[model samples]
Target: MACQVQLILAIFAALLAALPFLSLNSFPIRRLLYPTCRCFPGEPCWPSDESWDAFNKTLGGKLIKTVPIGAVCHTNQSFVPYDAAACAELQAHWNEADTHVSSPSSITAPFFADQSCDPFAPPSSPCSIGTYVQYTVRAAGASDYRATIEFAKSNNIRLTIRNSAHDYFGKVTGAGAIAIWTHHLKDINVFDYASKHYTGKAAKVGAGVSMSEISQALKQQGLLAVIGNAPTVGVAGGYTQGAGHGMIASRHGLAADQVLEWEVVTAGGELLTASPSKNQDLYWALSGGGGGTYGIVLSMTVKAHPDEPTATAFLQFNSEGISTDLFYETIATYLHNTLAITDAGVGSIFQLSSAYFAVVPILGLGKTKEKIDELVQPTIDALTSKNIPFSYESTQYNSFHDAYAATTVETPVAFGQLGGRLPPRSDIEFSTTSFTGALRTIAEKGGLISGLSFNVSRMPDVPNSVLPGWRRSTISLVTGLIWNNTDWNANLEAQRIISEEFIPEIDRVSQQAPSSYMNEAAAREPNWKSVFFGDNYPELLRIKKKYDPSGLFWARTAVGSDTWVEGSDKRLCRT
Candidate 1:
């Protein structure tokens, strides 16, 4: 009988864990160290059924109960989330790039990184709620966002923001909380008149607008927006928030530098217009401080450039006859001469491994194939001297869209990943010996290396909270190790390596933590304040308090997240 009672209690606990929202009797915990934490650890706080119904009615029935995307392929409960045929289809395409992106509840980052949800594996096993937001308010406008914010604040309910869910870190989801899904807020408005910041063509993009949507739309108007190469990434989501970098960075500057104005719903339940001339503090923080840390963005306007023709250089070579010495020499030569290459108006993605090295660069607007050839000719000559087996191509595209489409990389979901960063040019240019030594040492660590170099002619006038390393960084080094999504143990070891072993070795050599671009680095990065935001962190935190004093917004490793920690139950419990 005692054993039976224990079993019943365990089952009761499981039900509570899975409950989306609670009854009205859940009063605030006075003993709680973190006042902003709406739910108690292991004792979730949920809204009453009546309150929930009211909230749903307020949104005109946009709210939906939590049904994780992974539930389709597998389930933690006795029943699956879908029919057998649908489950089979999900399993078949589980590892594809777009499968996860298009799914409402799927997040690009490993869902069970915290190891909270049982059978936490992707598609194959049930992606139990874990730390994911329990209820998603599919926001259709600023009012929806504002309404959601007010509810979360007044009820002391933890809130998470989800747009594209392409975030590498698990910022978009939180365990046992309300979520604002801005993905449905798709609105695009164009302007030809002058504004406080810029006096040229501009695009007023909704928070849910994606890279491809804006790209294709602007292409028809003979205009272009500086954006990442991915087709599914949300334009105003984490992309621009982390100071987005891409093929056109050399020509147009980082995405954060293009912002002219932003429409946001703050923690105080008021709608705001943030720009250079208004709410300057919020503007700076929102520009690149990292999303989910400030407030929910409703819309943003960015300067648009004339859609022009582009030139590109592509090189792919197998390390068939390449020696270790020759490989390092090639890497060293590129590092030593990045200025000249980027000065010629080119941005590149270099993927290297012991077995292979590939470089695809999109030249700037108005540049020609000869110019592309002239810039990359040196690397080609060096490889030629080394007798390296190689193939090269230089092409001219009539539109930037054409050039961008040719070399865009689509990263698949379901694989666990992390990055090792390289500091700015001052660190890379420490000395020839130091530069190449660090490069060769980290590169030879065995994996893939994705390198990015940024060269800019002009920057926006507003101050931003982007990583200080970006100001001086010429090249960023990133390498990732992947494991089968179903192999939980392998995923564990991979995450351990990315945090404990991989990034540390590179950070030791590259001045500090892998500070490449914040959005793409490891979420559990050490001393992230100095690495991701640098000196700007202090001010960003100040602004965080100034606006959202309750610490209402929190992401895995965003600025000012040090004061809290996530528990095994997936709750952001106070320390």
Candidate 2:
């Protein structure tokens, strides 16, 4: 009897473990019996042609069926004749971010798109939609947002939200899913904003507004708001929702901190405003809880400050004349002075490798070029005294926009997986040995260490739900493995190293238990709930459940996403 009982228990345990995977096969029967799984293309419950037509009509013909951008190269897949010239042009500009952002369905990260469509492939090769969203709604306003949410909910289809498509962590693309593309909602309204709590100049920017557009609009009004390094990044989307940090973060605060109000469309298709005094929980959740989870934000009203003079610095050095050890040592010296640099209200974006070091640009709000040079003097002196060949430049501009234009360097997209940690001040101040060792190990592994350093210790005590680590962190350190799209085995190993090896090296020595910025964190990060939100995750989850009770929103690492699982077919189903 005991032997029989043991066998039964083992069998039961195996079945329980296999439950999530069971739905992958015979999905039609399983879905019919349970009716709990999300509907996808070719499924019995998927929306029919008439249903899609009706929905499109409601939006005044705004619905779009995705045609993979690379389809132009595949005659069988493309609607039009294959044009070799167009295919060549697409291949040439594939890495440029603007190429993807301009399209309704193309996301900047092609890895997430699963390479189902590749312009580089021979014309005879297959070109399927793969992981790209099957259909997109060019949401022009609130009514469109509401209708899309209602349709998604009633149809039991996986819904995705995308703006600018600048996602690094695969949050925007979903296979066999429908997405609301907010890239065309470009309305920027600047005014003298006044409320019961405070009064000032603010801009109510539409969800589609990019950093470049908003900066230009605000500059025209002789004002500025916190913006990210990428000008193409949307102002009211994932950037701010993930607690935006930028070149002036130390001078102001996070972009989330600048938000005064959010106009959103909820999961239930109701339009509402979220702010400190109204829908308080929704306000907190939307501020930094990560986008596409809480609601579909239509626009955000953010505090704008008067334009100011700005200075910037650029520095670069390579290992041509210096030893690798000496190069890292120079990097260490620079890292050691991060606290002082940020304290002086300077913010910077820098990169490191075993063979080179570069500070793309450092912003000094209201500071002159002389002051900028003084702030970097210690690192310059260290390089000079050690006879390290280097190039450095500091320039002052009449306005912050001019400085931004001069310093901004466009970056490529969809190249690799990203993993990072927000290293608290203690790591640089007290636990210097372990911190330095971690960075060295990463660089030795060919991981690019991109550091965005700033001081947020002075951020006002507010109720937003950003990673608590942000306030205590001095630098956000990101390192990752770059992989060519065709290598599955190599890509798997790269993901494992970044999630399991590279990030852990930094986590082990972090004295304050620092977390990661959700927007740039690794896709498979361990203990992601804690790594992304820390102590605030529980509350964020509670708010997610309350607002989206049926679990209408799901992203890879967004709040409360563990309940759903993606199968081999790339379909999202309830676990």
Q: Give the runs in model 1 whose Cα sits over 4 Å from its true position.
A: 1-36, 40-45, 75-85, 111-127, 427-439, 442-444, 457-459, 511-514
In model 2, what are the clashing residue pairs, if there are any? none
Give one clash count per candidate, in the order shown.
6, 0
Computed on alpha carbons, the lDDT of every model, listed in order, comes to 0.73, 0.85
Q: Estimate, for each residue in 202-253, the C-alpha lDDT of model 2 and write its tens digit.
A: 9999999999999999888889999988999999999999899999999999
Instruction: Pick the TM-score winner.
Output: 2
Candidate 1, residue 379: CA error in Å?
0.7
Give the TM-score comparing model 2 with the true structure, all chains together: 0.92
Model 1: per-residue lDDT, tens digit, 1-575?
98986786576556656874732334433223235445642443456678889999999998977766556555444335545577667667766657756655566676443433322344344345666676889889978988888777666777888888787777877777788988877788877848655799999999989898898889889999999867788999888988888778888888999988889888887789988889999999989888887888999999999988898877878756667777777766666556677776678777777777777664556688888788877778887888877889989999998887776767666565777575656555665456666556545665556787767545557677677677667776676777565566776676677777666766566554446578878766766777778788889999988888877788878777777777656677556
TM-score of each: 0.89, 0.92
Write out the backbone clash pairs for model 1: 22-46, 131-174, 131-175, 421-514, 424-473, 425-472
